[model samples]
Target: MSKDLLTVSLDVYLGADPVLCEIVPNSSCGDVDSEDLEKQPKRSRKASVKSEDISRSSASSRARHDPVSVLVKGGVAVDPSLEEPLRSNAHVLSELDTVWHVMLNQTNISMNSNKFYLIQLLKSDTEDKYWVFIRWGRVGYRGQTSLTSYENKLEEAKKFFCDKFLAKTCNEWSNRSSFEAHPGKYAIVATKFEVPTKKEEVCKPEPEVLQVSRLDWRVQSLIGLITNLQKMEEDVLQLEYDASKFPLGNLTREQIEEGYRCLKDIENAINTKKFDAVFRDSVNRYYTCIPHDFGFRAPPLIKTQEDFKKELLLLETLKDIEVSYKVLRSARESKDNRAHVDRFYDKMHCQLHPLERDNDEFKVSMVSMYLSLGHGLTHMFSMEIVNVYSVYKEDEYRRFKGSIGNSMLLWHGSRVSNFYNILSHGLRIAPPEVPLTGYMFGKGVYFADVATKSGNYCHPSNGKCALLMLSEVALGESQVLYDANYTADKLEQGKNSTIGMGRKDGVRVPLGPLEDCGGDGGRYSLLYNEYIVYDVTQIRSRYVVEFNFRL
Candidate 1:
């Protein structure tokens, strides 16, 4: 990392009396030796280095020939080549020079200006002569070179010139005497400032391009405008800070306000108009002011680039949606819209099929649903073992341990007519609709009818109904059967007793309830307990089942 830098003002030196050392032609300047420079008081590291190098070399070189005329301006070496008139390539001043480059209003000192004054001593590299260089111009500008050589009384002549320059440049001072009268009129203020690295040092990443199809032109223009405005804001802030550090730059608060005004105008333009209408050439001039490479790899610009990319993607998606709508409208109006509309619809359906298909089906909690209804497995069937033999090459049939004929029998399924409707209506507990045609021989007919009829039984309050059927085939059957011996006694009693006759079994039994019954015997069991279903649906069935059994 680099060391910290300090900013100083040029006015601070104006009050100091010019030192007039007699200049002897062909004679060297009695600059301080290295030992003396190291002893001198200093604040900047670069300044100390310059002073040390010059002091160390001047003494020994001076002893060999005529001592060189050395002048230390702001603790830096006086290289005439580095100053104006010679086009010096050397890094003229140390990075630590505390020169306050100022811009002065030639007509008024109180007002801000861009005109600055600079003075330097130069030694001729080709000719054995010395010259003084003085200039007044804008900062970062090389207006013209003005040179004056001092052959005799050089130091005195240079002092007179310096005094005259300060008097003319500063509007407050009419002459050298007035400046001396009020030395404190101009105060020196110091502040922190950063010197940006050279452009070559900064890494530049590849520029990102947004490929928005329909609105590419509009989006690109808006992005370009936003980018330029953002850069202008940064530049203005830098100039403001620079002005504070160097009073001569004449960077005032007014200039900063102007920059903010420029940014606001661009923002207003973006918000008020459609992006397509923001293509004014005058506003486009901001593009020229921005750096081409933009240092996209830099931290500040990285976030800026990402924001632009996101905006581009959003615009692109919006454009796609709009185009899709247009295409749909055109398809509706055209007669031969099969190619365009049908293909589009097909592609859309394909994309949406996964979400819509079987979405109504859900895991059926048979345990919870059955328990809520006070119903459960009526019988747990035990498996019966059967032996089989296989005939091979031998005539006699012999049973082998590995090749025994085995038969697996699945149980007959039971159907609860109204219960199926409730479960099928709620998707949370409904299983996938199963094909009942070949599920279990003739048992599937009743199961298939229940599954189809349940669709209309959906109740809104209770979400979707789930199927109470299990995934695997049931392998059990109920064992409730009517006794043949009791049937003869029931028949004899039915023929002799009247409608109100009490049964001989002790308890009085009602007879008219089943008197008009049509005998269509399939399967039946006497219910021993009452069953109850919760209020998840409107109907809360709680009644004693006359004859119910799971088979």
Candidate 2:
């Protein structure tokens, strides 16, 4: 990309935060033609002679009030002599002992120019020197410049922040108290603040420090899981996988080991119950500097288009589900049905359709998602008859969150709807072969109705759940036994022996209100000691099932 078209981000350590007076960027740099910048409006400068000018500008119009801000000072600090060097783009690194307060265009600079090098900030909790960088090159600009230039600039910029502003030895205050955490390993930057300065009399209040009382061991496990997952990226690239597969390994054992070490370093903070501390430290080390004395910031925007729109929605939904599921399971454990659904509309809103087109991988994922979620909710909500249902539920959140994007796509495209259609068609409409799945109860109730999929539910009758299992049979074609004006004496075919071939095209039957067999409910149904409807929709067979439990 062309340098003119390039965008830069700054990582600065702001000791005071946005509460302080905004500092205008330096007016000059070591390189670049000051004459040109001086002659033209110092667009990089936040301070100006007029209020109207600020409003007129669009992108950088918003004045930033960071106690510490890094300025990009744009377009290569022009120096006539280094024209050749800058044009050729030779790598150069240097540090200046003098306070970088004044701009090369000193006549225009008003604030203390003590800060130089485009990026400067006091260390967090410690005082030390930290480095900020000026990465200039073309990105996305259709120029002859090599792509590596952009990458190189980014790498240098990253290094500058890591090495300088975040000097490991920095103290709480940058004035003098900076010190290294380890012996012999001095902080990348020298200590700046140790004792109070005379000028420091009144101080602004700081927000209450965020704290972690207990380490959620899950975090460590998750981090390790993610770290290991990288190893499988390339390996699984060929094998189809989605967010659900993020924890899978993608690399060799050695690389995985290295990744684990990195994960541990990151994990240690959480394990030690110091999440916010580590996070803030990293912020100081990485995000404090502004680029080129302007609004240059670089942070990976992990959110996608859909993510932005649905993140809050999904987050709230998840939270609600978690809470409600907890309550529902508790009520069941206590054998109470008082846990009425909260925000019923919200739950309804979550109902999503599946993809319209063929998405085999997505299809498989939907299958898993539905089954898992169904299983959890069923197993947790009801102690009995949980096994009678074929649907499963789960919130394997980590896996789901990762796959949410694609799964949502499928959901949007009617894939979700289609899935339900399949089940409906097989069990309630018609089926070639009876569908059969293992059932269990009250183990992992998550977020599904145990007795029925039909939203229509009645309060439990005593401790027993009343559910209706409707089985449909197509005349002569369906395997589910039914009594729809047909002969009742056929052991030749059908799921239940009590019923017989129906003259009608289809039929619905209530399966169970299973009376405890190590559970609250239990019941068995078969035309010939076997379920005849295999699955819904996918198979165009004649039999379907309609199961209803008054639950």
lDDT of 2 at 545: 16
Alpha carbon deviation, residue 117, candidate 1 (Å) = 1.5
lDDT of 1 by residue, 295-372 (tens): 111111111323333222222222222233333334443544244324333222111111111342221122222222
Quote the positional error of residue 324 for candidate 1 in Å: 58
Per-residue lDDT of candidate 2, residues 1-551 (tens digit): 11232221122122111122222232232222112122212222221112211111011222322332211121112111111322222222222432211111110112111112122211111122122222121110011111112222434434433443333224222332333333211122211111222222112223343333222233222222212222222212212211111111111223223322323333344335454544333322211111112122223221232322222222222222233333333433342222212222122222212222254455333333332332222322332322222221222111222311111110001111112222222222211121111111111111111222222222223343223222222223323333232222233453222222222111112212222222212222211112222212111221111212323
In terms of lDDT, the best-performing candidate is 1
Q: Best-fitting candidate, measured by TM-score?
A: 1
List per-prediction Cα lDDT, in the order shown: 0.23, 0.23
Could you give me the TM-score of model 1 versus the true structure?
0.19
| Candidate 2 local Cα displacement, residue 360, angstroms | 19
